[model samples]
Target: MLKQNLSPDLTPLRHAHRLATLYSYEILDTQRESVFDDITRMASTICRTPIASITLIDAERQWFKSEIGLGKSQTPISASICAHVVLENDVLVIADTSADRRFGGNPLYTGDPDLKFYAGAPITTADGVTLGTMCVLDTVSRSLTQEQIDMLRMLARQVMMHLELRRMLRLSEKTSDYRARMLASAAHDLRQPLFVASLSVQSLLQEAAPHQLKRLTLANGGLETIKKGFNRMLIAASGHASFTLAELDDTDLGDVLEFIHANFLPLAERKDIRLSVLRTRLHVHSDAVQLETLIGNLVANAVKYTEAGGRVVVGCRRHADHVALHIIDTGIGMASESVNTLFEAFRQGDAQSEGLGLGLWIAKRTAEALGVSVQIHSVPGRGTHFILSLPLKASTEPSSEPIVQVR
Candidate 1:
């Protein structure tokens, strides 16, 4: 009879437990054959047995996973001695099966070549669940030396290792598939806003008045925002490609702030907010592109969270051996908790906003790469102040320049 009815009280759980273990491997019918077959072949040759198999015990049969010298594919559990070895959950040795009580009356011993010798070791997982067995059989009543039995068990451990590798490979493929889908979805959602903004700007420029030109300028700002967001996503995807820093140049902080104010003033005006550049002509030696992106991200963040009619002030001060630039804004500033984890990649502490949560992280990393220091102080209800300190050129003396709002 097929051994389908698992006993509720004692040995019955073994059938169900083995079935569960077999399913967990996720390796049935997989075509990428590994070196697991070599173990079975080696085991057969070393033991000098004509038949050997790596059998996975199922609910009603013994599945021949990796077989050597076996013409039959699988065997019914009722006729499989390997199935009995799995049920016992230990190494089973019947030196002379024909002389034993359990095998003397069995058909596999009494009818088929009069089977007389058996040695099987349980293939158990790390958690002590016996999945199946690696066994050798012969028709003559014979005994295997102790060393042969130990080597057979070692080969069983190799089968367990093969199953574990297949499980990890499947998991890694799944994670990579999920990330690809996420990037594809994010690209689709962001394209709509960019297309609308570009279309609006094209229509406005045809018969634009001076005041409407300002409106067009503000609308064009959305295109830049979308582009910056996409660039940040690309940077994340191209993970940690190192950038080579060139020698710093003599760059004026005032010129950089003036350029930003000129570019963003119309956008701020459209929302009834005011933007001011309070200092000009403060010079330093640094990478201009890095400085531009770092400042742009900070200013963009300020504009995004601030309410209409609020003010954003950009200024710089001449410190002893460095120049300090500040961007202060009356915006919906972050809480203490958000500030604590602000520089961590993909970790957005504020749940109410929609973003990739990579701006501040990229900004901080860029600043560190350029040997600049950035600090922030904020309260949830009040506002935020971001301070950037850049080292000064040692040989050049400070130039006297007026503090004015320049276009």
Candidate 2:
């Protein structure tokens, strides 16, 4: 087997041609299964070879995805006899390794599990670049019957079909996962508005008294809460819906925080908790829709976990290259285990919280995509704080815009 380094510069056209050929197989680092294994086993039996391998040659190594009677999955490309087999246009056979000068003292023959005989067929895509070799090995020097050689070629064709089918199946699974997420988000959004309207109507039917008026006020507040929940769900679903970046604007961070304050205050008041914003003069280049969703989830979570009469604060600090906004709450903070998975999709620290378990996950992903970063700090019995950091300067030209603060 000749040892030639396949460098890109050595033959640019040839390298591109080979890549195209390998791509046609659509087999890269894919999962293994019984279907392909069965074919290898059958091929080995028919050929009467003690050891057989289905090997794919990568940049640095000859990789066996499935092998019978072999423990190692890889060997350096320089040492592979199959490397020579791939360069050939047809079946490569060594009638007897001991008799042939090319392989008589081959290291593989002198080392453990000695190789005395070799036979292989090239696994070439339709474009004609050999991606790898389908081979059988023997410990005793011997020649294969012509019928056996033909069977090996037929099995290689079946391997190519198996690779193609697996790729299509994986693509289908991804599409199905995407559709299911959309449906779940829709259900989460619709349940809120519908629940609020029902509750408002029921409150109206109660007797007109002091307690009744309080109930009415609480019900109206619940309607507002539902409105905000609907908005955030839309934000999260939109992020999942697209691959391209969305339109951004010079958004007022102060105004965004103020709006979230208005929505969360009533919930905080219901529990007799204090909610206040300590910073108001900051500006950021961001998507207004996603920025709103990010802050809203943090504030809501603070209120949800805090006990009665606890304090929750939202503030922003100015740094050299970035602005950091934090929502700190004296609440029932999560344990380390829960916090680790806090931003994972469909994970919940408290199953009782009003969410589809995607708020923090969406917020984390949306902030990152918009060139912002988020941090979380918490103590189990004390509280939790969410810090959002955004670059002071946009990736584009510096703007002369001033930071605005609303008291």
Candidate 3:
């Protein structure tokens, strides 16, 4: 028998955690972003549904981040199909809403849309707490193929990645000791998402077909990027004044490049930029998490500045006992004088560019901590190339104190 309550179990313990996790992202009631709208549009087309929405079920209402055809921005949770899915914590599908006894008396059916179909995949955080769903609805009775269902779920994961990225960036804005503590807390929270995402990719790979399998692989790559970034965030927060290496190990340059590709592919594609990575097996002896953080920041900044039709290529080569990681972008570059200030705190190169301009500064700090050198070459209105050089092996004389040196 179906549960009488349409909403989730309101047990104080679990419910509060779920709501707390949802609110922590600071996404509720925010203006719609094209990134999210793009996800919903893809769902509508892929699922062949007339109406699709990224539904966040808050305490009293379901706020739609990107409501494609619903016309309204939100509705009461009492009339929400997504709230029911929240309780199940999995993909929920109803071929014919009217035929389902669980939603028989729901007022949504009597509304203008007269919804008849729904397939919702949980938008679960790393903590395993479900905040909402990437759901598609149809006015006529219909069903989705297995592939469609998987794609829907995959899209939901992408939504979580964006939310996570935004959360980290928003919180990173505060540079106080208190902010570092908060960043540390946020970084620790990501542990749950990273582990869950890894396990999920493994399970999906075993059953996914060739095409779907490829996407799942890329999704795993995306997971690796987030995992490393947040782990580095923890490192940064823990030693706010001086970056610390959690572990010094053989870091694969190829894997880092692949991760960079997977994580930013969507953003680059959206900007009509060609993002490429050189296939390499070369390794560098450093903190794997720090490599991800610094390199991730460089690639992120490259993609942001590059114009449409421009290209960003990341590659590396061995030089003596060192490896020079190269990230070249055909973006609007800055003057050499402007480049000098790129690593300064709270610096902005382009007034029009969003962000506190702390990306490269963070990269510089991480590189210095790793005892590496960064070379930036750029021409205003031309392009930029950032080269990060580090020893192929760890230093023989390792100091416990933080290393501070000129770039």
Candidate 4:
């Protein structure tokens, strides 16, 4: 009597193509589903086998997508019987493992569950790539009838259809999420500034004096409020327009601090609060425009919350490979619980304060785009400090470095 060879040769190129097709489905390592479980259960019952599995051939293993009567989730590809079925791209049936020299020595045939009979139909894609097998296993030697074999192939096709459906559902979910985020960003950004402008107008109507000149002075404050609100709206719009890394560059930390001082000094003065900058000669890797917006928001927030005669200080602390730009203020600080939610858009620490609570949120988003880290420390009734740690940019020219305090 002559022995028959049943193992199919799996070439490297063919295996690579099969793996690529499997990955495109993105179904590997996903949680168990009743759909797949039902299919495997049906396969076991229809074939009169003790075990059935929908096995996927991964890079280094054969992972069971669904299994009945199997405790393990996966097995090594080297020891996998389905690995051979996938290579054949057709149904493989072994009536008796002990009689087949190819599987008689396989551990699965000799070990627990002691599989002596096996049949598998390859789960093939429409493009003809065989990703894995839908198979039945039995502890005793047996042969499947022609009808049973045909049924197994049909079940394999059903498995492929389910995988395709799952892929389509995942893509649809992602598209919906993207659209929702876009709508939320646009609505929030536009509404924030308009809300602030309305508040400013209301304040002007109530605070204006009888004398023309005094009314003009009162109107100046309201106009400033409108201007600041528009600035915030513009920044938010730009952030959402098309966020990318192309806006990044080597920016001077000192120059940004100076700009903040120039812009916010009058607002600080009108409130009878002290504002100062402790300048440094540090240059950091960041987007200059976005970095300025981030620092400006922090400073403005500090000024808004601080009481008359309180102080807001902007400075830098040097580190070995990075520098931390600190905005410290003597203000009505926040509770520890509130600190966590400070960066959430439209969340205000003090509902009584004027403006939409997007300042810190915008700052946080800008810092992320620049790959910088922002940290906060606050004590109720004492102060709040925002620290932005930035990577130090390399420079060719070395110059005198000094920390100069300016009021």
TM-score for all models, in order of appearance:
0.43, 0.43, 0.50, 0.43
Worst 10 residues of 4 by lDDT: 176-185
For model 3, what is the C-alpha lDDT against the true structure? Answer: 0.75
User: Tens-digit lDDT track for model 3 on 354-384?
Assistant: 4435567667767866778999999887788
- Which candidate number would show the highest lDDT if scored against the true structure? 3
The digit string of per-residue lDDT tens for model 2 on 95-154 reads: 666666655445676567877888888876555667777889888888888767877886
Best by TM-score: 3
Instruction: Give me the displacement of residue 397 in model 1, in angstroms.
Output: 3.2
lDDT of 4: 0.74
C-alpha lDDT (0 to 100) for residue 5 of candidate 1: 27
The whole-model lDDT of each prediction reads 0.67, 0.67, 0.75, 0.74
Between candidates 1 and 3, the one scoring higher on lDDT is 3
Our tally of clashes for model 3 stands at 1
Native-structure RMSD, model 2:
20.3
The TM-score measured for candidate 3 stands at 0.50
User: Model 4: residues >4 Å from true position, as ranges?
Assistant: 1-242, 396-407
Instruction: Write one digit per residue (lDDT tens) for candidate 1, span 45-87.
Output: 8788877778877777677777766666677666677766776
